[model samples]
Target: MRRIAGVFLAVASVLGAQPRKPIQDVRIDILSTMLTGNAGLGEWGFAAVVEADGRRILFDTGARPETVLRNAEELRIDLSGITDVILSHNHGDHTGGLLTLRRELGRRKQSAISKAYVGAGAFWQRSETSVLAAAKNAYESGGGTFTEVASAREIFPGAWLTGPVKRVHAEKNYGGTGKVRNAEGLWVEDNLPEDMSLVLETTKGLVVVAGCGHAGIVNILEQARREISKAPVHAAIGGWHLFAATDEHLDWTASKLKEFGVENFLGAHCTGIEAVYRIRQRAGLTRRTCATGAVGGGFTLKDGLRPGTLAK
Candidate 1:
């Protein structure tokens, strides 16, 4: 019965192709300070390093290449060791230092090469006004490879980039001084262009690394669950874009995340103090500050929380 055998094989293939269960051994390194200048007020940028299956993937080069480089040097994070670089979105603060980083890594002896990953629309999103175009051009000119994805894709085994999360919640009224304006002189609404987040299938649960959460942290979490089938969110570290969030918005986000069993949260950069406090007040959350000048100040997926060692 060749026909019957073919049907059975097709069904097996469909089930096997489903997204695999959770993954483990994911680590995120905060390479730069959360705030650029002062303790509370400063431009925000973050560098996230993800380690999965013995490969190093860098996500988002901070606002300043020097800062990222210096932090990497101090942390002993070898830039030459990085294999992939993922830009979350096309903002200057996220991609400003990419050029410098590429140059530095290219000079290494081992020549640990890096490929740039981003959303397809990132290139055409008002490139003149945004630094994304510059970053892309620099990487391409440097002989580095580039890849574009329209939606979530698995970059490594059990490691996924949740591309362009759909904003399901009603838009919240939030404004800030660092808002980006388009060529029309209008503040771009939260049309986050396929903002990506890293999802690591951990033995404990899923570890989510967010750049700015412009795609909405709740949306990221929901998509992660749908992708991996409700695996516990072990930890979420990076900018939450909560500085401008209303109290109601903050409360709702906190309530929603609580149900997902997020155990550790390292709030930094755009996550306002008030929002951090709200998240800390919730049960099962341990808060750690990820400010600038905080060398050796990162958490490990295997070792758990690590406090900020920045000098006062």
Candidate 2:
């Protein structure tokens, strides 16, 4: 019986020594962005379809009503199968196609988007000019639901939402001249408090996806570190909103990326081409690792990053 016990212990030791299986491939398909090469339309907006752990989530809408819809149809990507949608913030460029997406995609499949996940203060404004305010009413009345996440939480086993990232870095990215009233009837600068990002956990590392990075990419990463894991970031894909970043700011941003160990970077939308190049130089990222994000490009675990038009 001693030999039997020893054999069992050996097996247990080996089993314990084995590494945990990595999560399945999380495929990200960019449906809207500034650049497009696959005969698809390009616009000044952000929208992507993320397939992770057998769930499909539309990250954001687009600037115009037809941009995302036309691109999706052009790319031969079906949005009808997706039931979950995440609105990164309340900006028009990010939420302009909310109604169109739901209406068009829902026509094909009634359950195209059953629920929308948004930040807590996304619809804080009641003005008629507020796109989000209009969407909230129209959306809810159409039998759809919205869940406002205020803090970091795992929406699924391997997918997490870094809700309302804490601005822990010197990156106060937003500089728009807008204001909104809070629940207490106090008006404040619309610094996009509803800004957030999606963090996906995999065996390699965490993959952070952002809409506009208006909350500051560093802030998003810090929140992910606190809520998700402190592991090296495997990839960061989406709009960086650094169109007008100064040299000093870009250098600081690059340093932060290096500090977080970001391996792959896809800078899209307001993440100016020159900014991507500068950051690449400072962060020691190669063309293959750090490339501009386009309408027909994205990243996935199985095939790695599908670089954009300006990959070179």
Candidate with best TM-score: 2
**Considering only N, C-alpha and C atoms within 3 Å, which residue pairs clash in candidate 2?**
none
TM-scores for all predictions: 0.82, 0.90
Candidate 2, which segments miss by more than 4 Å at Cα? 1-22, 126-128, 310-312
Per residue, candidate 2 scores C-alpha lDDT tens digits across 200-222 of 88877999999999998888887
The sequence of per-residue lDDT tens digits that candidate 1 reaches over residues 1-312 is 999998998998888865565555665667754543222223468676777757788888888756676667666778787768888877777887787887877788324446888865565544246777766666776787778777778887778888767677744322333443544656565365557788887778888887777777888889888865478887777777877877777778777878888887776667666777776675335444222223345567677655454421
Error of 1 at 61 (Å): 0.5
Q: Specify the highest-lDDT model's number.
A: 2
**Model 2 Cα shift for residue 69 (angstroms):** 1.4
Superposed Cα RMSD, model 2: 4.5
What local lDDT score does residue 30 receive in model 2, on the 0 to 100 scale?
Answer: 89
Worst 10 residues of 2 by lDDT: 15-24
Relative to the true structure, candidate 1 reaches a TM of: 0.82
In order, the Cα lDDT scores of the candidates are 0.68, 0.85
Model 1 misplacement above 4 A = 1-22, 35-43, 109-113, 171-190, 287-295, 310-312
